[model samples]
Target: MSTRTDTTSQAGARAPGQREPTAPGFERLDAEYVLPLRWSEYRTGDVLELTDYLVRIAPNLDVTVVDGSPDDIFAAHHQLWADLVRHVKPDGEATANGKVAGVMTGIRLARHRAVILADDDVRYDRPSLERMVAELHDADLVRPQNYFTELPWHARWDTARSLINRAVASDYPGTMGINRDLVLELGGYDGDVLFENLELMRTIQAAHGRERRVDDLFVGRVPPRAAHFGRQRVRQAYDDFAQPARLVLELSLLPLLAWSIRRPLRLAGVAALAAALAEVGRRRAGGSRVFPATSALWAPAWLLERAVCVWVAVGSRMLGGAKYGDARLKTAAHSVPALRRKLTRADGRPGRGRRSTTSRPR
Candidate 1:
């Protein structure tokens, strides 16, 4: 094993530990790879500086970068993209990096067995990548764990959210490894989705397919800047429309948390219970220790922040349309008073018959 990171792409870029199908512990089919990255000008310098390293890890990788920036910025990376050994660019546009672009890129690799959808900045090595590929054997899509090992205060605060996510076996939204034909057959991701990976995961699950969230397969992600956290948090909460149950649970928890604040003893007891649940959920999901156990103590604070964001997001959506970069997060669909389907008539009347009727005041 080498301690050094290779920053160049070559024909024979080595994938150590990516084993043969018959190799012990390697049950998945060894298939060719295609990667799609969504790019913009703001992160161009940082992302391109590391793409070479990405190619070294997947030398045979068919990497395509879909740019959402201007023509000039595209030109800047054009030569570099040309020089890179493992990138494929057939069509280009600024679709804001959602299902549309993802499908476009995935379409190019439809002939291949697998398509790896990723952000422009995510760089992973062979071992982690192999684990991800292996994990894909069990399901239609696999979401690898991407986290920051060492975190500052802002990231640790964010960590509480991640720990709770494990309770639902929620996939990390930054990257996806999906079977190509399945992606095509499933009609790709939902259009106009802000959280593309999250939407895709749920879409696959909704279709009666299994989605695996791989905890053993991990990748390092640069912690987001502190200033961006609140805006990003709000935007993410807004996208919780894709998972209504989660939104409902999060929304419902807020009132209880607030009420408990007036009673110190109750709040402590609730916090203690939440902390224990968080710990158990994390371990069960095979989550990393990136989220400190002590951080779970802030579950109330996390829930309150999310509740505020959800309200603001709902209000913004109702009042006016939201632009992607704007700090006021909004979704096209109104999330407040979430619409849940119960067995009932289309005319808003309760249905007749024992199976369809509801039981009340029995």
Candidate 2:
């Protein structure tokens, strides 16, 4: 484990003290694969992935950035991560990237004993790696939680999905304290990168026969207010009614309530009513009462976004294409299979984009 030290300078620089990184202890295995992102440009609503990367890992550690200013539209750099990992030398100890890139970076860089895969939007109070190092003592994996500054509606959706994933979706051994090596042993993230973090956690549990653990420092913050509200409509549209079950079980009644009106009007009325109720429920559930009017206006847009996502999801799968973010989705697109195979290879095979695997930690 690393040791922490607190140091304050006369110039008003306060470096929170932490255990000195056991870089020396792990010196024999000191190297790590690092990825940092600075995007070229993206639409206002599309930069969360990049923002998430900057906020999460930049303060605590150095990163490896791609040379040019990359655009932020997800597809532009979707496979860029896979290309970057192949450039990492085997002597490197670990690797990490943000959003899709970070996961791929870590998997490709896993030649040594330790690898850290993290969400880049989170901020650690101190140098982040120490927690992973200490937990690495007997644990196979370590992951952190998403700590939000002000919970946005989109963040709430993510929270719901994450909670469901952790609390009830599935079970695996040693899942409480997730680790990189354990993830490798489980055949890597299998492409659908959306839930790789959970996948890694599950993989660790399966390999080490224990649950993954959480640390005190793993915290995340919400996006900036401008970004939050500006993009809120799009995210809500994409998320809120995307699932049939959520629509049928949770929101279906709204349209029925407003049915006599025109279709758009009915949907609008239902959306407004539902948003109000959800706000009330949120307050009742011990959340803040600070609801924004923009949130109400955006609710209907999410209905449209949800419809599009559902259509896309269904179409993609039906046409032998997996959902956009899953590994199998890549399989349907010929370019991804070769890259995926390269990104997930073990045994030092020089395959581009193949990932390396780790043994089960005893």
Candidate 3:
């Protein structure tokens, strides 16, 4: 890890009173391939626990925490983690989506070719972390599956969403492993998009980079507080705007429900079909082992919620955009063709626009 300190008066620079990072007691593992772990967060609640986690993984991987918290919180984090991991702030000119700025900065600073990016809540065990890093050698990106740990009611409710996603396709996880060179090659993805993950994935696809989605590679994630989960309903729905087909399907749901209201049997059949689909998703990719069976039963309810929230998300769009932290972002994600044009123009080469291939674990 680089010990060079930022001398510029930038947000990520060490505060005057902040202590310099100390050499910790743990010994680095003698592994042929070790990746850096980049964790991004604006404000974190579980500071101590997360520090402990960083300590546990310190020997196996280089870790960096790109924090964008207030001065007091930043100082506190530096105090706790400076000795254990690289703790820094987001760059002063971060994108509208601050997390992306942190991600970009972390990747730029990583010592390894491959790096793992994660949210504050995502927790990786040794085996899963190593597997993701190893898999990245064959593909440009690796997306692992996330399941909630210590499920609350809201957690259970959200698990239904994951199950449905898994049934139709792979679920979008909080953490991903990517080859640093690929992102740098593309000049970093657009940071203003609402669905940042999808934006990154699409950007890779636009550049004809290979992606791997490990459906059975389960990583534990802490569920958001109930109140936080409640606030995310419409915002989460707004992400579907990135996928026109899915957005169209969600937008038609309410009207379909109203049309079927007069026919009880039709409504029952629709609900059953939703549940059945969720069940199939629950069983796919060894999900039955990690996800609860009852979560599949919540599919109809979750779909109903999306049916209503999607309209609200549309309304927000018409009014300008949805609130993300302090910024209101309208665009969910750019189309692949648009990104391909942008990339081609950037490099002065005809973009191949090759379709991305997914490598699933057998």
Please list the C-alpha lDDT of all candidates, in the order they appear. Answer: 0.55, 0.38, 0.78
lDDT of 2 by residue, 1-362 (tens): 11112211111122222233233334222323344333445443334343333333333443333322333333443433322232222222222212434454545554544554443333443444555555555556544444354566664443333332233222111112334454544545433432334444433433333443442333444444556444433323223222345435434433454463567776666667645544442333112322232333444444444444544544444565433322333131112234334434543433222243332212
lDDT of 1: 0.55
| Tens digit per residue, CA lDDT, model 3, 278-313 | 999999989999998788888888989999999999
Q: Going through the candidates in order, what is the number of backbone clashes in each?
A: 0, 56, 1
lDDT of 1 by residue, 1-362 (tens): 12223334221234332222123453333644444543444353354444445445444344545543456555555545555534444353535434356456655554455666666446565566676666666556777766664577777777777677666555365777776665565545444546656556654554445466566566766666688676687677777665678778767766877888799998888778767766765665446445555766666567668878877666656865344753332343422112111212222422122121111111
- Model 1 lDDT-worst window of ten: 353-362
Highest TM-score among the candidates is held by which one?
3
Instruction: Compute the lDDT of residue 67 as modeled in candidate 2.
Output: 22
Residue 129 error, candidate 1, Å: 1.1
Residue 181 of model 2 has an lDDT of 52
TM-score of every prediction relative to native: 0.72, 0.43, 0.87
Those runs of model 2 whose alpha carbons end farther than 4 Å from true positions after fitting are 1-112, 127-129, 150-178, 183-187, 192-194, 205-209, 213-218, 222-312, 319-362
Instruction: Report the poorest 10 consecutive residues by lDDT, candidate 3.
Output: 1-10
Q: Which regions in candidate 3 have their CA more than 4 angstroms from the true location?
A: 1-45, 350-355
On a 0 to 1 TM-score scale, where does candidate 3 land against the true structure?
0.87
